[model samples]
Target chain A: MRILVTVKHVPDLQSQRSFTGGRVTRTADDGTMNELDEHAVEAALQLVEAAGEGEVYALTVGGADAVVAVRKALQLGVQHAIHVSDDAIADSDVFGTAKVMAAAVRKVQDEAPLDLVITGMAALDGLTSMLPTALAAELDWSQATLASAVSVAGGEVTVERHLADAHETVVAPLPAVVSVTDEANKPRYPNFKLIMAARKAPVALWSLADLGVDPASVGREGARTVVVDASPAPPRENRVTVTDTGDGGTQLADFLIEKGLA
Target chain B: MTTVAVLIDHRDGEVTRPALEALTLARSLGTPVAVWLGSVPSADAVALVGDYGATEVRVVDAEMRLAGHAAAALGAALEDADVVVVISTFVTKEIVTRLAMATGAGVVVDAAGAEIVDGRVETVQTVFAATWNVRTRIHTERAIVGIRPNTTQAVPADTPGDAVIVPVTVDRPATRERVVAVEPVERGAGVPLAEAPVVVSGGRGTGGDYALVTELAELLGGAVGASRDATDEGWISHEHMVGQTGTTVTPALYVAAGISGAVHHRGGMQASGTIVCINLDPDAPIFEISDFGVVGSLFDVIPQAIARIREHRAG
Candidate 1:
């Protein structure tokens, strides 16, 4: 089995986040591998282990700082790391990003036929949950998303997809794109040996030219939707906080009644 | 006026609140057309669509439980639409993505609302975990927009629509995926979380005992929600989780019980109209955004609140 897991470098959830130029401001200092992608990395690693003879490739797209994402993937034992970075790749929308990802996947396929592509259900920073589908569409591969449980056998990938009303077991052909939810598995922590080796690991750096994806077809110029305005939400007014003096609940009820919210 | 297609979401022959909400939003954009995928809709369902100002109901009889298949069937009905609107859900987002890919339309998901600004679809959404409001315009002719539930209030049209029924047929694309089996999940009695006007959620503070949280929700006729902490602890099903990556709720009243209101938790419910919190720790971040906050154990405060509500009803 040969699998490529897409990872992202994202602002830590605990840190303050803001948007500049109508895009998320990314600084090298405070970013880490997206928390959710760990589950994707775990899924890919587990699948490789189950097959007993396979390769797991972790790939990311960003500027120089995004190498950290693939390095973190290496700490979890991915055999290869590739970072696709370019000056022209900034401000890319989901479609633009998907185009870049499809190119990178094809480059890897050139090395050897890849059996599967895995990604987290959603990126922590964007939370758009659109890339897996768009990438599959770009690659014209079968897509299975939001998988709570996944298994591969006989060139077919099966996933237990959870929905609002029902749980569905979906089956798709190999060379497909799959996105796994956090419920798929408990991500394993990086051990001391793996963490040390990750520091010295070699990462393959690619550009839009390397993947043959047009620079004009990605980045801000290729974006189909443009953010016109962005601003912070104004704070709520007339906030009242009360300490419990044995009547806190009554006070809450009175407040609710006053607002007709009870 | 351009055609604005609203994908009607229904189950068991009844329409969901979000679908009506989508139609309500659609009416503002242009000629509202309701797209129904599956067997023929019941008369009441068709009327409900018209009541919300859908000028036409185009039913595509097919099996679309899987998004990959649904996207293919949906593409045909959307050919004439300038904008495609659907209630943003896990399944529908993928469907919208495929539709956009097929038609070369710009797409936006998790949007709060969409409007035609100067002959193009402009979408308003809360991003960066609901801390920021963003306005984005689609550059393409057809825009696939996925609006979150409960963001727009559903109002019937001034003059009810003359919903002309149109049957649509499209060759189902040879999709690469198929659903082999489906199992229904049982949910507790209450309003669905996404559409509930009042949401009462518990967290680590509940200590695995949701009796009080569930009681408070039941008292208010609200849905019971959970912080990622509680859901991760297996205290509640993932469906009940209210967080950034989980279910985002914009209820009229959101009551956080024992949740510390991390950015993840806050992103989901901060858009609510009224916020209240009960936490033993006075310093919990949830208090910052709350209109009313009580520094006390949820166990004690919830029972008291529930009792007062029951008493208020009796009086």
Candidate 2:
């Protein structure tokens, strides 16, 4: 019943997000754990608690500040945390990121068998929604993604996928990868005791060399995609403001009629 | 001419509009070859592909799963093609990623338009929650691109409809995820949010009462949408949320009632043709983008507007 949840450290969406030199300019000052990943951690913790004898570990890959994501997970009741950071891992595309994460998961498995790997539906920054499948391909495990609800029993994992058009139930065997949506659970706020403990917890740090990964196969050099050009969106203009002088609705209806939109 | 492979998504032998849009976009770059993943292509499906300017349709008789296997199937078949075009969906995103991994090609998702520039495939993406448009080129010999639906209108081209049955070896690893059941959600009756020509959205200003919003949407024959705040408060489902993280919509007319219009929510509906806003706050950000603004309470404004529209229609 041991589970590993993948978390990410991303720039807060409320901040002014921009790109520089054909790359996303992420400032560590405003970065925090991806909001969606909270559901993954919550789901894993619930599963472990329900089973009564298991552990939940949180894993993240980013720069030094990324350890904050793992620390956040520990505060949510996860037992162990691992952070894989290397200078060469910067600007790694989705494929390279998946490779590094898969390698790290394997390394973790060597110490203890992993029954499940969980992740959020998508990172707020990239919004790719491709990592869970890529990691499943790398680990050669079954994958169920975008699950709104999940339950594991009898060496099988079942999930309800809440797609735009329909709701579907999907099932995969044990040792599978699954990505949960924000509707999966409400993440509990860390208690004062756990919050203090998390600040003091030692986060295991691993390097690319430690994972036996070739530096040349990842990072900017290994990325397949390139941003040729970027530009800001044109500013919106030509707005007409109307004050409600008791006939505002009449004016609005007239405006819609004038535009042939009513 | 370079060969462009377009994945044709269909259901029960009917070609979806997004698939036709993909084919139309593919035809702009090079010779388009439609790759049908399901059962043998029916006559109507072949004709539809031809109308979208596909030179030839390649039918792959395989049960495609959302898992990475469908990408493997297409990747194996598209070895000779220069570019692969797929509709950007939850399933196709993963397929495109797998295709890139298998072929050592770069991949782009959510592209609004794509064309060959300087002998390289260039894709324009609406990034930063649709606040910016970034042009990118995959630095590879071959490229896989995921085009968002409604990015461009599907235009017909003169072509001789031809079909080819290609036997594909799907080199998919053992599937990790399997769909056991599919239940249709009960949405009652209304145009789908993505396909509707008009959308009426409410926000936190609704104060947990979507009655006015839904009524106005029904009167307008449009879809009902909600801001993230409303959805977060359990007033509506996340699917109906229109924002950066929710459904991006481009409709002819969008009515914002009680929405203060945060940047994230504005990103989803800014592409709409005409916008109308009704809010108590005159200084709401929504007023900046709206073509018509009514500074009043939605509870007071919506009912009057709806009644006037109905009366006008009856006349």
Candidate 3:
């Protein structure tokens, strides 16, 4: 079995992010490596390891920073790394990003047909969580989102989903796309040897032209939705009425009463 | 008439709240049509859609298929629908997203609110982990929107609208993946995080002791929440994690204990109606946005608060 995992690089949530005149700016404090993508990479690693005789390829689209994300995937257990790079590919919205990724995946599949494609359920930076869906549409594949557990065998894939009210178990055939949730598994730390190897590994860089992608149909221009304006929400009034005081019973009751009823 | 597709979310034949919210939003976008995929529409489900101004209710027999399989059928009917307003749960997001792409329509997710702006439907999204609110206008031929539940109240219209059952075409793709089985979670553990009115969250400062947080939540009849640090450290379950990388909650009241109020953490619960903080550090960031704050340790404050709640109950 061959597995393909999509990874992304974004300002790490731990880092402080600020926008200067509508553009997001980041600093060293902001960590990177699209956190959710880690879950995807981890899932791929576990699946390949479980198969015992399979290959896992990590793919991403970005700039030099993206190489770091791809390298991290290698360290985590991907046998190879494919990083699609182009000046035109930077800063694309969800729709455009999905298009570029689809193109990359198509090129990879040409060389190595993937039995399964895994991605993080959502990127914390965009929070749009639309890429997996868009990619499935472009590739015309079945999709399972928010998968908590996935096991593939006999050309069939079984998934456990974390639903709003309950858990749902689903079984689908192979050659499908699955977006993993954080609950799926904890991402493993890359070993030092693999990290060193990742540093030395040659990351395959493909441009839009190299991938045979039509720039006009796959970037910012092709986006169906565009942000008009973004602003801070209106300030909320401060209504801090402390209720838990030293008094055990009366004060608690009084606090509730002051808010409305006693 | 424009066919507006509404994904009816249900469990055990009972329609979920967010699905009704989507139905309400669908009415404003076009001629409302409710599409039930997994099971036959119960009388109760049909009535809910009828009350919400759905002109038609389309039910596809698909309890045995993978979740995404039924979406193909709905997408065909919605190929010409002016708009599709899907309840944006994790399940529906993937299905509706595929439908949106297949139909070549514009897709928007986590839409908190929507309206016809300048003759085009415009929607608001909580972007950058709720740090920024963005409004986008949909100018495409078809609009696919994922609306956040509870953001808009679902008030069924007084007048019952016309209902029609249309034939839905299902094209099962030759996919290798299928759902083998489903195991429902235990019941009545606590309020569903999304629907809970009050949430009591603990952070790294709890030191792996959730006993107090649980006690406080039980007293208030709320759900227990955790920061990413707690979940990452294995001190609490990931289900309790609430942050930029975790669940986004908008409860009526949110209580933070032993939390430093990291920016990522704030992104999750900032939308709450009221925020109260209990931290040992007077300078903790959680206090900045908190409506009420106590400068003390959890060891001191939580016990006192729980004791007070019991006292009130006894008195």
TM-scores vs. true structure, each candidate: 0.98, 0.90, 0.84
Query: Pick by DockQ: which candidate is best?
Result: 1
Candidate 1 on A183-254: residue-level lDDT in tens? 899999999999999999999999999999889999989989999888987778999999998999999998
Off by over 4 Å in 1: none
Model 1 CAPRI quality: medium
Sort the candidates on TM-score, descending order.
1, 2, 3
Candidate 2 docking band: medium
Tell me which residue pairs clash in candidate 2: A142-B176, A143-B176, A143-B177
lDDT of 1: 0.90
| Candidate lDDT values, in order | 0.90, 0.84, 0.74
In model 1, how well does chain A match by TM-score? 0.98
Spell out the clash pairs found in candidate 1.
none
| Two-way lDDT contest, 1 vs 3, winner | 1
Q: How well does candidate 2 score on lDDT at residue A248? A: 82
